[model samples]
Target: MSASDWQKSSYCGEGESCIHIAHAAVDHTVRLTESGDPAGVILSATPHAFAALLDAVKENHA
Candidate 1:
C-alpha cells in the first residue's frame, strides 16, 4: 500500500504523538509516525483484532 493512501484517524488531529492507520485490502496497517518515511514500521492486523483492541481500551478506561 502507498504511504499517501494512509488515512489518519478522525480522533487524531494536528498531534505529534498520534498514530496513523491505512487499510490494505481487508487488513489494517498501523504506522507509528507520519513522516512519510518509506522505512516506517507497519504493523498489520485483522479488522476483528483491531476492534477487539478498541473494545479493550474502552473497557479499561471505563
Candidate 2:
C-alpha cells in the first residue's frame, strides 16, 4: 500500500513517535507502522486481532 493510504492516529501528537494505520482491502488485514520510521517494520493483523489489541490497551489504561 502507498504511504498516502496510511492514516495517522487522532491520538498522535505533533511528534515523530506518531502511529499510522492502513487497511489492505485485498487481504482484509490491518497494517500498522511507526511514523518515525515509515520504512521500518510494518505489522499486519486481522481486523478482529487488531480490535482485540485496542480493547486490551484501553482496558489496561483504564
Off by over 4 Å in 1: 26-38
lDDT of 1 at 5: 62
Q: Write the per-residue lDDT of candidate 1 for residues 1-62, one digit (tens) a residue.
A: 57786666667767544566766664444433453443564566677777788899899999
Count of clashes in candidate 1: 0
**Which lDDT values do the candidates have, in the order given?**
0.61, 0.83
The whole-model C-alpha lDDT of candidate 2 against the native structure comes to: 0.83
- For lDDT, the strongest prediction is 2
The residue pairs that clash in candidate 1, if any, are: none
TM-score for each predicted model, relative to the true structure: 0.60, 0.83
lDDT (Cα, tens digit) per residue for candidate 2, span 13-48: 888577898888999998898874446537889999
Best by TM-score: 2
